[model samples]
Target chain A: MVLYCEICSLPVEFCEFGKSFKKCKLWLQSNNNEIYNKLYNSDIKSSLSKEEEEKISNSLAKMQLKEERKLERDLINLQNSKILIKRIPRTKHKYIVAIANLDLLDPNLFDMKKTCKKFASKFATGCSISKNSEKKDEIVIQGDVADEVESYLREFIDSNGINIKIEHVTERFTNKKK
Target chain B: MFKKFSKDDVHTRTNVKSSVAKTLKSKLVSQYPKLEDVIDEIIPKKVPISLYKCEDKIQLYVVNNEILFYQQFDDLIPELRLVHKYPDAFPSVQVDRGAIKFVLSGANIMCPGLTSPGAKLPEEDWPVNKIVVVYAEGKENAMAVGKLAMSINDIKTINKDTGIELYEYLNDGMWNFRD
Candidate 1:
């Protein structure tokens, strides 16, 4: 019989119920530790000293803090990172700068319309924002602004002290369209 | 697996010649011969077809605003759910739970997944080297469409790897492709 996980919709064999699927496992640990522990460690009962419990909790907090700091560092590095600018193929030199995974980004810090306007004034005649139904925002420019937009975004974001990284969706490429 | 396509580039055909329509219909019928009876019904006379030449290698065939089929690398294949609309249109094989991740990630269906206990295959006339749809064992929706790399008998008998070479699946360019 085929089995599936209620959580992620993955097949049960490829899920936590079976062997070696870490995605659901990680999701369970983060979202519902009780269920995760029950399913995986249902029979195990552990007795620990007060000092040991305190140490475990402290270490877990430390690990979480470390992860948070690493995330902050990654965000900071994104400001100085080179932007990926690309020309949308099959079009007449129409360019686009796609920024995906917006869910991971702070919505307050990033403004699609504001960024589009800034992109339009410097590089293109005008810009349009394509707001994806899937929540990703794409900024479309009429002309080539790959280089200028990258530097402009880096400087703008860095100066504003917004905890975000503006990355060009695709790698910068010279236009083969004549 | 998906590439962005502009809506402006889609070529809408308001009317298709009876001769052209017959030929196009026949082409689909030839690839999926079992659909010969109902092919004409689905693709009625002068049925509107919107052709989107998105990338150099991929072209999308949209009907009723939903992508019914796609042509990639010179081969025309129907979309998964489109195949599901007519359940018996093509032969289907079910993959066990172990193989869903790889299939969704664009990996070819492995032999073990299909030969596994929970997997199911057609009793007869497995379409080999032709387009067939694949469904995850417990899921009602067909997840992918691929050319069966090996016949069902061969797949069951041969203890080898890589069963179906999936061309398009959920989240692939064809799935997300639209005008």
Candidate 2:
């Protein structure tokens, strides 16, 4: 069973990155004060004196310069990382669709939920965007339209001017009859 | 090497027996005798150790709710800034301004990077085989944590021109690890 926050219903792991974390923090304050204290004072101390700030900034500047030199040293090792779209047969006529490498797309222009909703509307009625507990986003459509969806995404991304190469990966589900 | 870690994988990989946790903790204490005083504080009382693989040759340990330490070459090295935020939790060495980029990019640190006016020498006994946190000349938080290649005396007397080994650093698979 997927664990979700009782207050906001977001996945427990992602609660900290979502709005539900604020509610969780409020609950922690009243019910688990010890935990609240631990989380509150967990990170590095934020307060720094002027001299410390100056020293850190100077180090940062020097570090940046050194980083440039390192980058120049390794130009041949660069390799292309591709975005993968996978289709797997879930049932007789249904499919589970997953799109990996969403980081290649600009977040401002690419909305996973909206794009999935639009794509599913063309072929099936129960198309929706679902997120795993780990927060990996996937678009699920009820009916099997894997071929159509793959072509549609290609045209859609091409028209949008994104420079990412997409790889189509297919995994067929095998049923074991006992 | 960086990838998302599912909660299911976490449970599978790290669901260690209590006996295993006890043994691991004992091995850790044996490795770093200085941790005897804070052994209880570092190891969780009842919880099983959660392990996350941070690339090849590196692994992270999560006890209770915090990522307390990482392991390399059979040595358990505690998380520098993330763990033991107390002033004297771990020994530290400061690197020059130019070394920040290389450290973040997962490169082994060189002696030239530490030969700066702002560099803080590691204590005489603190350098050899010890897990020391690395900080930039100006930064308060440690940018990386790594095992030292040379003792303070070796560094003082035999100035090596090349190949100073460091265990781990910022932006390495360990730092970017998520579960």
Candidate 3:
């Protein structure tokens, strides 16, 4: 906790920085040390002139904004840190495929017929969808790897009875690439 | 020593104010080779990974501005070797800020056919403890992810909601949190 003047219960962090030292000097010149110190030590408020009130409010607002910005920056940092990727080699004959902004699904979570593309991305090689997602689903698969990928997904979705139903695309994503 | 600060001390106009920026920047460079030339040397980066080692299995997480490798710290040097040079589990994969950005932008990020959203732990408090990304379709040389940035309506605005939103993309690609 920092000490402040009885006239304004601001955190008197002025001593550390020469820049703010003048403000502390001013406060000390007016108020008695004991009363000022008591007020500073306690979380008490003091009457201020309109101008002083504006300054204090401005300071508090600026601090709050800084805190929020810090929060956002930290969130970005955390997102950058937690984000993961799986390595897939670029091979011939097989093409890697991915979809963005899953606009094809009925977010109502009840409709299924219009959800063709969603299912394709999920069950098919390029799909990577999950129940935890209420929005912003995407899918990606590489090359003819979909067949192998399909088999791969089969193992993960086993036993729980959530076999991903991929609409058969006669021309595999491999043929479409060329 | 944290203290109640006022705007007088803050540089609101110019750049990152975090002390950890430099640390994160270095770590991004040392860990991800492709980004060495792209990142400005004067920004706060990630810590150097060369000194850290993987205690257990590690996952490579990527986002818009940085990449982080999540691993248990047992023998720091060995893990550095594994992630940098000799990756036994998933070879030839390097994590960086661009790849992370690309992934978060909704590009397809690829790894081994198998990947867990990763360890059940929060990096801080967000549910994004582990993410699943794949090498994007069409863009095979790069890695990307299906971003959790936009909402269903936002995706609909673009008329295509089947992939990650690119950061440079003008409309839907930018990450926006909507309830």
List the DockQ of the predictions in order.
Answer: 0.05, 0.06, 0.01
The per-candidate TM-score of the B chain, in the order shown, comes to 0.79, 0.74, 0.25
User: Could you tell me every candidate's TM-score relative to the true structure?
Assistant: 0.50, 0.50, 0.17
User: Residue-wise lDDT of candidate 1 within A1-178, one digit each (tens)?
Assistant: 2233554454332343222235567766776677567656664222434575466445545655665578689877665554334555435455555544433434466676776787677764668877656655566676766667667767766887755555545544556765
Global lDDT of model 3: 0.33
* B51-93 per-residue lDDT for model 1 (tens digits): 6665455667666677777777756788765665787787678
- lDDT per residue (tens digit) for residues A95-140 in model 3: 4443333332224442233333545565553344432244544454
Displacement of the residue A78 alpha carbon in candidate 3, Å: 40
TM-score of 1: 0.50
Interface RMSD of 1: 13.2
Q: Write the per-residue lDDT of candidate 2 for residues B1-179, one digit (tens) a residue.
A: 22233333342345567787888888877866666677777675866777766445456678764667767577677764343254356677777655665665567667666655656775555556766677765454566666668775666566564324555554344444444
Each candidate's fnat, in order? 0.00, 0.00, 0.00
Which structure is stronger by lDDT: 1 or 2? Answer: 1
Candidate 1 clashes: the total is: 1
All candidates: CA RMSD (Å): 12.6, 13.5, 25.7
Better model by TM-score, 1 or 3? 1
